[model samples]
Target: MDLGTSLINVALLAMLFVVAVAIIRMRSLFAIVMLAGAYSLLSATWFVVLDAVDVAFTEAAVGAGISTALMLGAMLLTSRTAKSERAILGVVPFLVCVLTGAVLIYATIDLPALGDAASAANSHVGAQYLERVQADTGVPNVVTAVLASYRGFDTLGETCVIFAAGVAVVLLLGFGERSLSARSDKGRSRKESK
Candidate 1:
């Protein structure tokens, strides 16, 4: 409602759109990857304007950091720096675009407005949590109270899942410089052993 917040939201949206265009139009693989990071940052800022701080944090970390790193690493391991040099005049791509756009438009239609008060998401267990929070939970920060206390087990499980995902990515990426160098050295030394 405040003028500053409104201006910030507008700026965030504009930046998001600009980054989206940059990502789409970029030719350099590295530049495109960095633009994807910029897009994630803008998206996270937009999420923050919507009061989704948790979602924003996840987007900033997982979406921007880890995802961009994975993508760039994959680019390093592969030779294809750009997509196939195919034109978009074909019926198959046209049908796909139309279907995709229609699905997205329908999704936008069903989405709750920016600040709709009566939306089910706004009035659901979130409201219930705020209503009986003091008496039921005796905690101050409801989000922390919910994640660390009420849903502690679920949070623990989710944290474990995230850790597992990180480990999996490490394994898939063959890890970092030290391990990679050691592998090369080991390969060379194995010939000496033989």
Candidate 2:
């Protein structure tokens, strides 16, 4: 990658880290959901820097857009603020997360460098796909050809999954006579009255 693109990627990663920290610390459901969306957008930007525009588009649309909307809808059924928890109770989960992160980082050590021409992927299937895509699919753009022709069923499956998720979220949040939030509020009021 060029220096400028690398710098942009680093900046986006930093932003994503900051957003993640904010999401972890915040008690407000709305704020946390917004930060999660922002984190997804930063991730999409980094993917773009890596020349994975298709993945970036998917991240932006699904992660930032649809997922955020669904989460906000789900959040409406719960209290706006999270219940406070004892700090000691968080220690085990925090340590588990740290260990998982360390393991994941260590696992990347043996992976080939990005864009390495000698890498197994770049030297084999990727090259073969590039060579045959145009003739097989009659598509000039390899990415389009791969998605629309080579992996058509996979793409359709993904689209169906996203659509199903949206429908499920809508049904969960909006199908009842009263919103889940309203029912919860009414129950709280009845308890208070008693």
| Candidate achieving the largest lDDT | 2
- How do the residues 1-194 of candidate 1 rate in per-residue lDDT, one tens digit apiece? 88999899888888888888877776678888888988998898889888989889989998899999989977887664576465558898899999999999988988887767688876888788888889988998898888887789999999999899889978986467877798999999998999
Residue 12, candidate 2: C-alpha displacement in angstroms: 1.4
- Residue-wise C-alpha lDDT for candidate 2, range 1-194, written one tens digit per residue: 68987788788888888898898888899999999999998999889888899899989998999999989987987889998766576788999999999999999998999989899989988898999987798888799988888899999999899799779966876566576789999999999999
Q: Could you tell me every candidate's TM-score relative to the true structure? A: 0.72, 0.78
Model 1 sits at a Cα RMSD from the real structure of: 4.6
What are the C-alpha RMSDs, in order, of all predicted structures?
4.6, 6.2
Which runs in model 2 stand beyond 4 Å of their true positions? Answer: 89-95, 163-194
Worst ten in a row by lDDT for model 2? 170-179
Candidate 2 clashes between residue pairs 3 or more apart in a chain or in different chains: none
